[model samples]
Target: MAKLTAEIKESLAATKTAYFATAAKDGTPNAVPIGAYKLLDDETILVSDQYFNKTLANIKENPRVALTFWGEKGGYQIKGTVTIHTSGTIFTEDVAWVKSLKATLEPKSAIVMKITGVYTIKPGPDAGKKIL
Candidate 1:
């Protein structure tokens, strides 16, 4: 697992939305905008599934996912494997977190992503280069 640097963490926190990408077992691609995500630790991220249809189905087919976000500091693409939690400690925490943000929104599941790689998305010579 790759640990996220402080700079990358800050950038992720500053980002209001992230582009989440996933693929089916047969390699069909799907990408969606996500706003309910939290950095659980240096190597983990928690994402709440409020309105997921195809995304959840793709996750069931393939656990690999990529999250890309950009902010004032810079941009990065995070590649990881996910575990879905519908009813457990993680899901309970996700519910509380989402409720704190907005009581009206209900999370269907909690997606825990374990970081495997981090790459630069910033335009330059370092673009697409793996940093961790």
Candidate 2:
């Protein structure tokens, strides 16, 4: 697993919105903006499933996922494997965390992503290069 750098950790906190991508069994790609997401540690990223239908379904079909976000400086894309927690301590914690940010929002589940790769998404000569 690739550990998140200090810069990327700061970027995640500063980023207002992040894009999460997954694929269906048929290879259909799905990407959506997720506002309720955070880094649990260096490698683990948790995304609260407020209201996901196709996204949830796609996760079951394929575990591979990617998340991209941009801060004031630049953007990054992280590729990883996913594990969905429907009912557990993680789920409970996620609901509480999301509720603290968005009181009225209902959290259905938590999507836990284990970072395996990292890449620069910023537009430059280093774009698309794997940093980890």
Candidate 3:
């Protein structure tokens, strides 16, 4: 697993929304704008699934996913493997976190992403270059 750099972490913190991409087993792709996500650690991210339909279904079929975000700090693309938690500790924490943000929002599941790769999304020479 790749560890996120401080710069990337700061960028993620500043980002309001990220584009999450996933693919079905047959390679059909799905992308969605996600606002509920947080870095659990340097190598892990927790994403709250509220209104996911195709995104959740694709994850069940294929665990691979990519998340990309840009902000004033910079931009990065993170590729990871996912584990969906509908119940247990992770799910419980997710519920609490989402509720803390807004009582009306319901988190159906917690998507734990174990980052496998980190790449630059910035333009110019190093675009798409793996950073970690």
Candidate 4:
């Protein structure tokens, strides 16, 4: 398990769009820009499955996922394992939040990822170094 620092949390919060990557069981890769997502806690992030098809299928076949976000300064890549929730307290909460943002947004499911590793993606001497 990895813990998210305050700086990382702030960057993620300010990020309007992030890239989520996943691979199918056969190793086909899928990466997409996710607009409806949020930090559920220090160790968890939630992504709404609004129009996910391949991403959802890949997640079900393989839980591993990677998220990359570029902020004003730079960005970091977060690697973790995801659990897809369709019906549960977390799902309900996520749906409500999505609805509040836009009543038209309907989340089919919620992808919850537990932070496992973090890496700096900012172009610098420390780029690609694992922070956690």
List clash counts for every candidate, in order: 0, 0, 0, 0
Worst 10 residues of 3 by lDDT: 68-77
lDDT of 2: 0.91
TM-scores of the models, in the given order? 0.97, 0.96, 0.97, 0.96
For model 1 the TM-score comes to 0.97
Error of 3 at 49 (Å): 0.2
Model 2 TM-score relative to the real fold: 0.96
Residues 1-132, candidate 1: write the lDDT tens digits: 999999999999999999999998889999999999999999999999999999999999899999999977777999999999999899999999999999999999999999999998878787999989
Give per-residue CA lDDT, model 4, range 1-132, as digits (tens): 898998898888888989999999999999999889888888999999999999998988899999999966457899999999999899999999999999999899989999999999978798999998
Question: Could you report the Cα RMSD, in angstroms, for every candidate shown?
Answer: 0.8, 0.9, 0.7, 1.0
- TM accuracy, model 4: 0.96
Q: Which portions of model 3 show Cα errors greater than 4 Å?
A: none
Question: Clashes in model 3: which pairs?
Answer: none
- Give the 10-residue window scoring lowest on summed lDDT in candidate 1: 67-76
Mind giving the per-residue lDDT tens digits that candidate 2 earns over 1-132?
Answer: 999999888888898899999999999999999899889999999989998888899998899999998877567999999999989899999989998997999999999999999999878898999998
